[model samples]
Structure formats: C-alpha cells, structure tokens
Target: MSKLEIHQIPVLNDNYLYLIKDPDSDAVAIVDPAVAEPVQEKLDELGWRLTHILNTHHHFDHTGANLELKEKTGCIIVGSKADADRIPGIDIQLEDGDIFEFGTQKARIFEVSGHTLGHIAYWFEGSDALFCGDTLFALGCGRLFEGTPAQMWHSLSKFLTLPDRTKVYCAHEYTEANARFALSVEPQNAALQQRFEDILALRAKGQPTVPSTLGEEKNTNPFLRPDSPDLQETLGMGGADLIDIFAETRARKDSF
Candidate 1:
C-alpha cells in the first residue's frame, strides 16, 4: 500500500469536504462534497480525476453536490446502504463492516447512527484517518436527530475501539463552540480548560482545530467522557448508569 494524502476543504458555514488521494496511483476520492464548484476547483487544481465520492449520510449539506459532481467527474457515488434512497446519485451502497478500496487505500465502514439513523463513518486504517460525518465532533457529539440517547452512546462507543492515534476527520468545524459547552459541564477539569484555551487561540487565528486525534478527544471531549468523575459530579449524577449520564450531558449540550 502507498501513502495517502488528505486535504481539508472548508465549505458552507463550517462544514469540511475532504479530498483524499493515493499518490502512487493518482486516484482520488472526495468525502462529503457539500458543493460542486469548490470540489471541481480542487480537482482542477490538483490535476487529479475524481474517482469516487464517499458520503457519510443523506444530509443535504453532505450530499448536495453528489449529482453535479458525479455528472461532471463521472465519479461513482458511495454511501450507506441504509440511506440509498435518500442519498442522491448513490452508485455504491456500503454497510457496516464493508471494506471499500480505491487505489492503494482501503476504508472500513462503520454504521454509527445518531445524527441520523443511516450515518456511517469511513475509517481508512492504512491512513490512520476516520471520516466521521456528524456522529462525533471535536469536543461534542451530533444532536440526537433520529436516534435515541442509548443508540448515540452505542454509536460513539464504537470509536473507542479504534487506535488512540487515529486522526478524526469530522465534517464540521464546531470545536470552539463545543469547547465552551464542555467547560460548562466540567469546569474543574484542567485538561478541558487547557483544551478550551487552545481552541480559542486556534479559532482566533482562523485556523482549523479539526483532525484531532482520538487520544486528545478521549481526554478532553465531554461527549466521550461519560465516566469522568468530575463530569459525573458536575452533572450530579454520580453512581448513575453511564447511559443516563451520557443522556443528561447531551441534553445539557442541546440547551447550552
């Protein structure tokens, strides 16, 4: 296998569209192309042809460019099998545990339903990258739009099984705001405090705080720390079930 290169393209509001390429083969795939023009521009700039479009869900912001990009680049659209009907121009339907290969890169799909029931994340183990669309964020998790709190908990738990060094490539740049909410829930956490300051500086400079490692998120992300004594105490849910604690934390974030 050859080394893969991933480029982050900022799109609508805070969304990020990734351009992944296998340098050896010159094969490229676009992840969640929110729009067609910018993606096409990127492909033109790189002088690479788009071979595939990997969509994480059916959200308009994520798949809005599916048809146009496919028509323009003749790329095969790939998405969750569960969302085939909702995903525009889907040519390849993937399910949990499916292995999708392009050039020298292989990605394992994980059906992490929470933000949406059909939301799936692509983990390119060879590249140490996880393209998690909305299921997990920098410091927070996606809103419970279609799944239950328990289901979201289960979905997020799956990420814990990955290597701590895995780089998380989430779909949005919501770290700054998420940091604020995290601090509210774990005010006494020194790790969370330092992370908030770091996020503040990064956002101030118009820098991206994405591609955070799983290790960093496990230590600082409140959504992934349901067992933290400090967070449990802050929520006044000490000794409560982890799922309930997680549910309470999510609810607070929703209203935060």
Candidate 2:
C-alpha cells in the first residue's frame, strides 16, 4: 500500500485539524475540522478534494465544520453511531470495531468514551496511526465531561493494548501544561522528567509536540500510568484499585 500523507492544520486557538491523503488514489479525508475556511484553503493548496470527514465526537470544536465542508466538497461525514443525533451532516454511523476504507487505507473504529459518552477513535492499522480526538492527549487526557473515571480508565485501557509504535494524534496542543502537572505527580520519574524537558524545548521553538508514539506516552503521560507504583505512592493510594488511582490523578489534574 502507498503511504498516507497527513497534514496538521492548527485552528481555533489550540485545536488541530488533520487532512489525510492517500497517495495511491489521491483520495482525501479531514479529521475533526473546527472551521471550514482553513481546511478549505489547505485542501485547495494540496490540490486534493475532500472525500470523507471523520468525526471522533460531537463536540463543537470537532464537528463545527462538518456541514459546511460536506456542502462544499460533497464529502461523506463519518462519526459514532451513538452520537448520530448530535453530529451534523453525518453520512456514516460507525460502531466500535467497525472498519471503513478511504481509498486503499482501512481504519477500525474504537469507542473510547470518557470525554464524551459517544467519543470514538480511528485506528489505521496499516499506517499505525491513531486519531484519538479528545479522549486522550499527548500527556493529558480529556476532562470527564459526560463519563466517569472508571469509564475513562476502561476507554484508555483499550488504547494501551495497541502496538507501542502506534502514532497518537490527539486533537489539542496541551502537552506543556500536562507535563507540568505530571511532574508534580511523579517528580522522580526519570523518563517523565526527560520528556518534560524535551517538550519545553519544543514549545520554546514554537514547535508542536504532537504525533507522539504510544510507547513514549506510556512512559511519560501520567493519565496513562495509573499502574505506576511511584504515582500511586505520590497520591497516597498505594495498593489502591487502578480505577481509584486513575480517579485521584484526574481529580488532581482538575485542580492543578
């Protein structure tokens, strides 16, 4: 299979809109476009027409451009079946484990609820790329807007089973702030400390710290490390259930 070309377009303060293209067939898909103008501009520049719009959830920041983009390009909008009523212009309703194709590329849907009950992520096995909207972030996870800590933990556990080399493409650029909060939780984590410094340097240069590998996040993201003894000890929750540890970590982050 030919390699897929992915472009990251920054919009609406910190949200990222991804434009993916299949080089073999020149088919294009845009993920979670917060606005239409910028996405349209990028599509014109790439000389690629949008054929699909993949929505991870029904949040405005993620689906605000769906209707406009669909009207403009006649692209089919794909989103979670659970949120069909909330997602605008949805053409395809996807359930967990459902597979869809964009040209030669195939993606499996994962219903990862936490940030939102119907939140879903797209995993492209061939490309080892995961488009996880707000459910998970680079160093942080999304706030519990409509789901419980246990639900979020269960959702996150699904991601942990993915290949370590999978590339994580979260929606927002909140890594720097998340790193600061992570340090307070596990100051002795050598890997987390190193990653914090690396993120600092990247942000200093006005660079993005996204597209981080799952392996790297496993080492550094506190939200994904409820099983870490150090973190559990820091939270004074040693021998606690993983769900309890996760809840405490998320609660601390809320105040941090």
Candidate 3:
C-alpha cells in the first residue's frame, strides 16, 4: 500500500498549505505553500525534504512562497505551463492529462481552470486522493474570480465524476461557513444538517477540517449537485440550466 501523510499548514488566517509525504522513500510534496516560514518549520519538524511543490493556481495566496521554498529546499515547483508567466519560477510545467510519479505514488493532472485561467488539480489514483485547490470546497466552490460561469461549471463537473470515495483536500478551512450556507439551502437535508453539527463541533475544539471525502461532499455539497431539486429550488430557479445554478450559488456565496 502507498503511504500518504498530509500536513495542514495554516496561513493567512484560513488558507491551508498541504504537505504530502511518502514514508517509503521519504519523498515530500507540498500543494499551495501560501507562505514560506510555516512550511519551512513544519518540514524541518518532520525531517522531510520537499521534492515537488504543486500549485493549484497563480493566485499570490496559493503560490507566494514558491520561489522562496524552492530556493531554500531546491525543490521543483510545478504548475500549469499555460500559467508560467503568472506563477513565478515554475520548473515542471504540466498540462492536462499529464501523469507523473513521486516515490510509489502516481498523480494525474486535471486542468480545473475556473478558479483561475490555468488552475489545475492533482489526483493520486492509487491513494484515491485529490488536491483540488479552490475548484471544489467542502460544501461550496470558489468565487468566479477569473473564468466564466460555464468554465467553472465544467471544471466542477469533472470533479463530480471522480469516485465518491476520493479524498478531497482543498486549500482553505471554510467548511464551517460553507456548511452554514449549505444548511440554509437544504434545510431539510439530513446529511447536510448532520455534517454541519459535526464540523461545528470540530471547529469548536480548534481543529482543522482538511481532508473531506468525495462521498461526503456529494451528499452535502450543493455546488456539486446543481441538478438536485433541493439545490435548484434554493436558487429560486426551477429547472435552471447548470451554468445558471452555478452562477446563482456563486453569487449568493460572494455575499454570504
């Protein structure tokens, strides 16, 4: 079995910087190092050297520490080749459909480009793990900062196709607020209500909600269930097109 260890480096109040380690080879991979100091400290504490830095997008909060971390650890910084100019000092410029291995774990790159024009997500098929960045959140999706509604809809649809058991690691700890919104939309949804209570308790103890399974997300995340009657009705649009449903939800969340 492939060994996977995930570290959540809290940065900028709510952002999460993920460090994935393979014990067999002592290989390390970081997804979205928002800052250098904390990531550096965590790696030193764990005695793990970073081999690759996986970028989800070109946003400063996601890739700000890339150059500094690369310089400090001599690690390869990877991101969408199309975003090379935006994401500084990228070494491994990957495109959609690219597959590569880190130790015994292999990852497939998916161009989930709605969060940013060239955003990407990494999937470890063997581990059933997904580093989705800002594309799909615990119970929501990122605001449409760059891409169109249609683009975001398409990107989210791709994620919804993954196996329900896939573990999703997003870049932030917005689950509490997101679950609150989800409950508002699906008040009668037993799963959403239960999840809200569970996550509330988790946060109450000052814990981090990092990895959420795709099965749980499918059951409670309304953004991924635009076709569901509950979500469609909540948006006040009956039989609305997928793009419209996505747009409405995103608009509501921007103010939420």
Candidate 4:
C-alpha cells in the first residue's frame, strides 16, 4: 500500500487542517477544515483534486468549511453517523469501527467522543496515523463540552490500544499551553520537563509541535498519564482510582 501523504495546514488561532493524499490513486481528502480558501489554495498548489472531507465532529470550527468545500469541489463529506444531522453537506455517515476507503487507502474509524458526543477519529493503519479532532491533543484532551469525565476517559482508553508509534495528528496547536499545565500537574516528571523545554524551543522558532507520537504523549501528557504514580501523588490522590486521577487532573487543568 502506498503511504498516506499528509499536509498540515494551520488555520484560525490554533486549529489545524490536514490535507491527506493516497498516492496510488491520487485521491486527496481534508480533515476538519475550518475554512475553505486555504484548502482551495492548497489543492491548487498541489494540483490534487479534493475528493472527500473527513469531519471528526460537528463543532463549528471543524465543520465550518464543509458545505463550501463540498460545493466547490463536489467532494463528499464523511462524518460520524451519530452526528449526521449536525454535519453540513454530509454524504457518507460512518459508525464507530467502520472503515472509510478511498481507493487503496483505508482508515479505521474510532468513536472518541469526549469533546463531542459524536466525535470520531480516523486511524489509517497502513500509515500509522491518527487524525483525532478534539478528543485528544498533543499534551491535553479536549474539554468536557458534551460528555462526562467517564465518557471522555472511555474515549481516551480506546486510543491506548493503538501502537506506541502511532502518529497523533490532533486538530489543534495547544501543545505549549498544555505542556505548562502538565508541568503544574507533574513538576517532577523528567520526561515532561524535557518535553516542556522542547516545546518552548519549537514555539520559539514559530514551529508546529503537532503530530506527536502516541508514546511521547503517553509519557508526558497529564491526561494520558493519570495512571502514573507521580501524577497521582502530585494531585495528593495517591492510591486513587485512575479515573479520579484523570478527573482531578482535568479539573485542575480547567482552572490552570
């Protein structure tokens, strides 16, 4: 199978839009577009036709360009079956675990609904790539906008099943701020401390620190490291339930 070529397009204040391609078939798709002109410009620059719009959720920032892009390129909009009513110009409704195929390229769908009840992530197994919208971030998870902490925790657990090398293509550039909050949660985590410095350097150069490896996040992201004894101790919730550690960390992050 040909590798999936992904182009990261930073938009708005912190949102990221991805333009992906299946080289074998020259099929191209965009993930969670916030605006249309940038996508159109990128498509024109690459000379690749936009064939599909893969929306991870129904949030306005993620789906704002769906209708316009679909109308402009005649691209089919693919979204979660659970949010079919909310996604504008949706052409294909996918349930959790369904495979979205574009020629030889295929992605396994994961319903990771913490940010939104119907949010779905696309995992391209062949490419070892995960395009998780807001459910997961580089160093933080999305706020509990439409679901409970238990629900978000369950959604995050699904991601743990993927290989450690999986590249996390989350939907925003919130890593720096997340790193700061993570340090506040686990100030003594050596890996997190180093990661925090690394994040600072990256942002200093005006660089993007996205597409973080799942291993890196698991090691440093406070949300994913709720099981860490250090984090539990830091929160003074030693010997606590993992979910409690998670909830407390998330709650603190809300205030941090």
Best by lDDT: 2
Question: What are the per-residue Cα lDDT tens digits for candidate 4 across 1-256?
Answer: 8889999999999999999999899689999999999999999999999999999999999999999988888998999999999999998999888998976988999998878899999999899999999999999999999988888999999988899999999999999999999998899899999998899999999999999999998888889888888888889998988888888999999999
**lDDT, candidates in the order shown:** 0.92, 0.93, 0.86, 0.92
The total of clashing pairs for model 3 equals 0
TM-score of 3: 0.95
Candidate 2 local lDDT, 125-181, one digit each (tens): 888999999999998999999999999999999999999999999999999999999
| Model 1 agreement with the true structure over 134-241: per-residue lDDT tens digits | 999999899999999999999999999999999999999999989999989999988889988888898899999998999989999988999999999999998889
Candidate 1 residues lying further than 4 Å off, grouped into runs, are none
**Model 3 C-alpha lDDT per residue in residues 1-256, reported as the tens digit of each score:** 6657877788898998888987678679889988899988888899888898999899989999998998988998889887888987798888888996788788899888777888999998878889989998999888888888899989888888889989999998999999988887778789999889899889999998768999999899988877878888877888978888878887888887
Q: Please give the range of 10 consecutive residues that has the lowest summed lDDT in model 1.
A: 1-10
**Candidate 1 C-alpha error for residue 88, in Å:** 0.5
Off by over 4 Å in 3: none
Off by over 4 Å in 2: none
Could you tell me which residue pairs clash in candidate 4?
none
Global lDDT of model 2: 0.93
Error of 2 at 147 (Å): 0.4
